[model samples]
Target: MSGMINLIKMELFRLVKSKGTYLTILFVVIFSFLLFMMSSSFGEQSKANMLEEDNALYAEITEEEEHIKSGGIGFVGVDFTRDTDIKFETIVHSFLSSGVFLIFCGIFAANTVCNKYKCGFQKNLSTYSNKKWQLTASENIAVLAFTVTEILLIVFILLIISVFYFENFRLGSAANIIKYMGMQAVLYYAFATLIMFIVEVVHSKVAGITVTCLLSMGFGSFFFNKLDEILKLNNFLVTQHTIVYNAKMLPIAFDGELWGTAATVAICSIILYNIFSAFFVSSRDMA
Candidate 1:
């Protein structure tokens, strides 16, 4: 236990000192900012158009009222107002459902794992430690920490930007946001572990990044969906049972069924990937 903890500590320190870590965070921030800005601009334009229509209708109604008072026939149209309130939960859902978050985090995880090999860190660690699985375990924990950090940072930045950009901004239910974010965090960790597993198996940075990027972008799910369409295996869709699919389809309002499905997928992925990663790490020659 002490050795595992020490290994975890070393992994965290290495992650902190790594330049790629900062670069990943920077890229996430920039991408998130740009996304929010574009959404905000589009929202503003929509609201402006709605307000203009509302004003024009109001003016026409006032004129009709005057005409009716003067004993002239005038029909006043029914007033319709659109709800343009942008909720915090909506922003979070949009961000998560886009799959961009997973892509960024997966790339970071792949880079972190592959860099260990490039820098000879994995070789040294394996040389000193008989239990090679501990290194994989430690890397998993560190990646989980980085995933959580990214989640919090993205949420914080979005919330701050929403406050400034949204006139009718609402936070919606606190409980719902918490539940949604909690599940997403689990899925993110699962994704990171899966990336680590892939990196361990491929043992190449380029392959790791390429495969993770494709997977994160939903290519894996797309292929699975197509296979399901072709096979029609008892009407069971494999894509629906995948982590990437669940993460992309997760709703802001928690439904027990969907939430359970997502939790199951994420938990299974985390366990299976970590087991495979540990086995690969232990069985492979680091020399």
Candidate 2:
């Protein structure tokens, strides 16, 4: 265990030196803040338009009170702030579940593994006294990378909240954000394992990274939707399962079905990846 811990520390050190790893975090943070600002601006524009429409409608209603008095087509002011409780929850959710962001996560996973292979780190590690300890350390390193990504993500999210809606913040909602980020970390850990499996099987960085991009970018969704149309296997897709889980993690009423599906998919993905990786890494040439 001590050896594995030491290896993890070394892996982290190597990760920091890998410029691509930091690029991933940089991209996620910059794009997340951009999206937040754009969405907030759009929301303000929409609110102004809605307010204008409300005034016009109210004038029409006063001029035509007989219709409203007949209990038909009454105008209540549009509640622009109707869903304010879920505002911050939504900003975090939308950014996390965005197709572009997910693809970046996939790229990050693939690149982390690719870097090890390209730099001959994996081959050297395979020569260690206990191969299992080395592999475990590597996987733990990927997990840690994903955890760090989640931390950066949450920090950016809260930064946005602080800028725009700090007054509306409640401890309960903040707790929910933390909980959702925890779920995201778990999902990303599974994803990193799957990417490692891909990297191992393909034996080429380009192919592995391309496959990761394809899977996370909703091409998988298109194929799976077609399959579901023909055979109803929607729940079996890991990407879809994660999307469902992310959507359900919002500050709203909980749905057992969504959480169950997400949990099942996460567990199955981890188990299957570990099993495949154990066999593939052990039997394949490390050269």
Candidate 3:
């Protein structure tokens, strides 16, 4: 127990000191700003287009009474217009469902795991402990901790940006946002563990990074979707069972079924990856 705690502490200390950690956080901030600008610009253009269409419709209506009865000349859709009340929860959903967050998390996990092997740090750690599984457990716990921190950072940055961007921005339902973020955090932890498993098994930084990039970019989900089509798995898409797909499908508004699905998938992935990682670590010689 002490060994595991010590290992976790060491991993966190290294994470705090690593340049890549800060670099990743910086990239996330820059990306968030760019996303907000692009989304806002698009929203303005969409609002303008809607106004033009509404004006043209009004010209054809011929009667003010008829126009007023016809929904007041206002357009309704999913586009984020200035008239649309923006919520912090909605912004968070957009940012995370973009898949960029997962990509960054995967890359960070790959680097964190691979760097130890690159520097012979894993071997040195192994000499002090015979229980290889403890190392896997500790590193995974540390990475998951970092994942939660990153999620919090992302929410904070987005909240700040939304406050300035939206005319009447709202914090939305606190309980809902907490539930949504909690679900995403679990999914992200699973993703990080999967990346760590790949890095540990391949034992090659390049290969691990390549695989992580592909998976993070949704190639793995694409392949599964294709297979479901080819195999004619009706009413059961293999893609829907994947972490990437779940992350994308997770709604800002809580849905019981989706929440259950996300929880099951994340928990199963975490358990399986940890078992596989521990098995490989125990069987293989670290040096």
Top model number, lDDT: 1
Where does model 3 exceed 4 Å of error? 52-83
Residue pairs with clashing backbones, model 3: none
Q: Candidate 1 or 3, higher lDDT?
A: 1
> Higher TM-score: candidate 1 or 3?
3
Per residue, candidate 3 scores C-alpha lDDT tens digits across 10-119 of: 88898889998889888877876776776777677756766778766444433532322222221111236455687777777766765667767887888888888888
The ten-residue window of minimal lDDT in model 1 covers: 73-82
Clashes per candidate, residues 3 or more apart or on different chains: 0, 0, 0
Error of 1 at 154 (Å): 0.7
Question: For residues 263-284, what per-residue lDDT tens digits would candidate 1 score against the true structure?
Answer: 9999999999999998998887
Measured by C-alpha RMSD in angstroms, how accurate is candidate 3?
A: 7.8
Error of 3 at 246 (Å): 0.5
Which scores higher on lDDT, 1 or 2? Answer: 1
Local accuracy of candidate 2 as per-residue lDDT tens digits, 108-164: 767776666677766666545346536644665655576556555755765655446
Candidate 3 is scored at a TM of: 0.86
Worst 10 residues of 3 by lDDT: 69-78
| TM per prediction | 0.84, 0.73, 0.86
The alpha-carbon RMSD values of the candidates against the true structure, listed in the order shown, are 11.4, 9.2, 7.8
